[model samples]
Target: MSKFFIFLFVIFIHHLSLAQSVQLTGSVISGTEKLPSASIQLKIFGNEDLFTYGFSDEEGNYKLSCEISQSDKFLLIAAYIGYQRDTLIVSRTDLLKQAIFQHNFNLKEDKKQLDEIYIKAPNAVEVNNDTTKYNVLRFTSPEDRNLESVLKKMPGMEVNKDGTIFFKGKKISKVLLEGDDLTGEGYKAITKNLKPEFVEEVQALEHYVEDNLLKGIINSDDIVLNLKIKDKGVKKIVGSIDAGLGTNQRRMLSTNLISFINRTKAFAFANHNNLSSS
Candidate 1:
């Protein structure tokens, strides 16, 4: 008789646990569009202790089973990236009265998240102090062979037929190679010859002053272009060569080579064309 009583007590406890458990079902949507992979979470209302969690299916349907305690209320939350989070308050008494509680989330687009995306976009331009930086890879394509080709596609910048660059309707005074004034006023020598693949960033400096002593004393209106090269290795070699043979045994050849090792830089260029005004 004592063994029978113990068995009955075990069955009663199992039934009590089942009676205290509740089922929660919901669907996540944005307007009429269902939001798949949305996260669903349930927590105690007052102390905010997590009780259960699940994720929506491809059809945006979610179901959660949680055990109810003596707490009077609980919180249900639905969340997704790029969308506003939704929360619902549920009562323990109501959960026990009904076997399943139904709720739906109508999430809205989050403007703050959109703003973050705009700032982090690949083509996003950034201006810090007097310098404006451009991501070289953003405006460059596979067809682009030289740095000049990428500059033409950048906004607020233009390249002339002679390979001169202009920024914001003002002619750039000079182009700097890795912060060093190597080419001086004849920047086309580097801009036209350097490969776009070797460059990582292009920066434009406003009111550029070449002399360090006259930096704050002299007020200048000059725009300068700076090329930031990519770090490939301790020593990097990048260049291209083109050779063509036309009619009458006419020949054309062009070659360019740029080398950067540590703090040293070297550039070499050669062009020969036999096509002359006959």
Candidate 2:
């Protein structure tokens, strides 16, 4: 009889502990659109330390479970790239009232306006009307070899496996190098070969019109990307040459040269390789 009573007591304690655990579920959204891969954080109301962290699933749903009963109050923070962060506070009374809580966060799109005269505005992201400009130098890292690599780090931008670029879930029509369409639809010629250091700004043009005269007159929803080459990098030739000799008398040589002078853009590529030994 005593053993049976002890077993029942253990079961009761386990159940009580489970009841005290708090589970929070919600969706992080931006204007009715679900935001996936959003960051979620939990912290005590008065403490600076983080209690737990999690990320939203592909459907923008997040679930957080924590032993928050001991805490008088706690805070939940939800954040996504290019969007404003949202926060919610829960008191102990709220937790005691319900073990499973439902809360949703609606994050707004973040738009920034920066002045060029600002002293510390080097890394600023600015949005004006329908265009967004990203300071390439700020996002460029030593590991980034080409413009494509730097584009991947910008918000709302994606580079497909086939070298295609997209912004805001829409495919861009063309890529302009120094205000000129060099490759039309095939932009890989510039994005893949041009080094990141030579580019100063990347402008994302929405509702792009190919002709300037018909920009506002024509109803177009095409997106375009414009690369602004650095002043120092222009009017000068830049490229590399590679030559290698392998075993069995195999040899390979390749060279790339690029220059932009007075509205004239030039690019030259040459490769000579031997498939078999002579």
Candidate 3:
């Protein structure tokens, strides 16, 4: 009898967990035309990467399942080839209480060229939902190679040599490139290698420690940073090699190769012999 009761308790807990999952159904379309295939993401408040992924079928319909807890905040981001990415924020205290949600997305075509009419782009700071954004091209000069230089121009932001990013005298949690942490490494990898020319925008998330929902529950005070990179649609291989020979039979060689292809980025290094690196 006791064993039977334990089995029933386990089944009940499994059902309870399943009941907490949010079932999301949506479609991706472009101006009344359904996109045959599309990609979607659920972006959590504080984390750099999306919480989950969904793919649209030939009918442009997609379904997603994710776990949601009380006070958790998130947004739906959808993307398609040759189209601009779209984001929809779903944060209603009452609506979140439900176990399922239905949402749809519309992606705009990525127009390559614009009309000859002179129209200025937004080159200033703007705030959207929970994110504060700055267009790097509009705020800084062309000669800047690293983001640290431009970040200094933003008010209440401080960049230190020790890879510390401070906003309002408070250190932030993480930094993202192209909506994802391409490299698990933190700010140093980005501020040093990413050039200003490729950056589309710099986004700062306010008060999103451990993904907003958890932060609210735990009373955290960490911020988040995101960098949006433009897709140039070009693949190229770039690298350099150096070889040296000295008097005391000393030799040095260093080679580094970097590749940025479609949807993939890779870096490889080859080192021969012991060389003093400072």
Candidate 4:
């Protein structure tokens, strides 16, 4: 009878596992319109652990499957490059049978207004401190090139051999594409991976932060790099490929591709290196 008991035990465990699995489905929309290519990240509540992440399809639809216990809670964070972040809370009680939960998100635009000051333009504004702003158009020419090469030529901006960026004297910790923080080793990934052709302008904001109370609170100075992208509807493809041969029979090749269709954007990249010796 031990053999019979073992078979029943295995079936019970299988059924319990299936009961704990949950499927989440939703649609993302912006101002009554579909928001394709939206980024969806799922994480367990109060923890840094990420369960699963994926992007929205052309129809602004996304689905994620996750394993859960009786007491587990989840947080869903949705973000698009230019749109504000949207967050939702999900608990074990929300999962009932195999059902489709529809969620439509409306994103808002970031806007700013400047106050008019009664002051005339001085003949020469004293710039004792080092300050610089790089217009993306200055670096990007008709000839397509990678972001690395373009950043090297930007005024007052320096890209080191190790792929770190130095502005004035402070290192850039974050690189934003139209105001969205790239997050997690931000500048390192952006300068190394993004293409120059996609950039419309590079804005350098010194002493950056959302709250003024926190400004200068920390001793270290901060600089923010903002990359304004071209309009998606006007430009479909923006990226480039680079290959070179050097002395001692050395070879290098790299390719980056970025394409945008309406609200959906796609990015892909590849690289190869070879060396020859006698």
lDDT of 4 by residue, 1-278 (tens): 99999999999998786567667788887778777656676677887355666556668887877666544677777765345678888766676455654566676643321111112111111111223345455445555445767776653456778877765435777777666664535566666777776776677677677466876675446677777776555458666788889987888887776666664555567778785321
lDDT of 4: 0.63
Worst 10 residues of 2 by lDDT: 113-122
Alpha-carbon local distance difference test for all models:
0.80, 0.76, 0.65, 0.63
Ranking of all predicted structures according to TM-score, beginning with the best and ending with the worst: 2, 1, 3, 4
lDDT of 2: 0.76
Residue 229: error of model 3 in Å?
A: 0.5
**Candidate closest to the true structure, highest TM-score:** 2
**By how many angstroms RMSD does model 4 differ from the true structure?**
19.9
Ranking by lDDT: 1, 2, 3, 4
lDDT of 1: 0.80
List runs of model 1 lying over 4 Å from the truth: 1-123, 232-234, 240-254, 271-278
TM-scores for all candidates: the values are 0.49, 0.53, 0.41, 0.39
Judged by lDDT relative to the true structure, which candidate is superior, 2 or 4? 2
User: What's the residue-level lDDT of 105 in candidate 1?
Assistant: 96
lDDT of 2 by residue, 1-278 (tens): 99999999999987775447778889999988988767677777987356666667768898988776466787888876556788888776686678688888999877651232233343335556778788886667789977899998775577988889988658889998767887889888778877787778999999888788997798999999988766534467766777999888988987666687665887766668896431
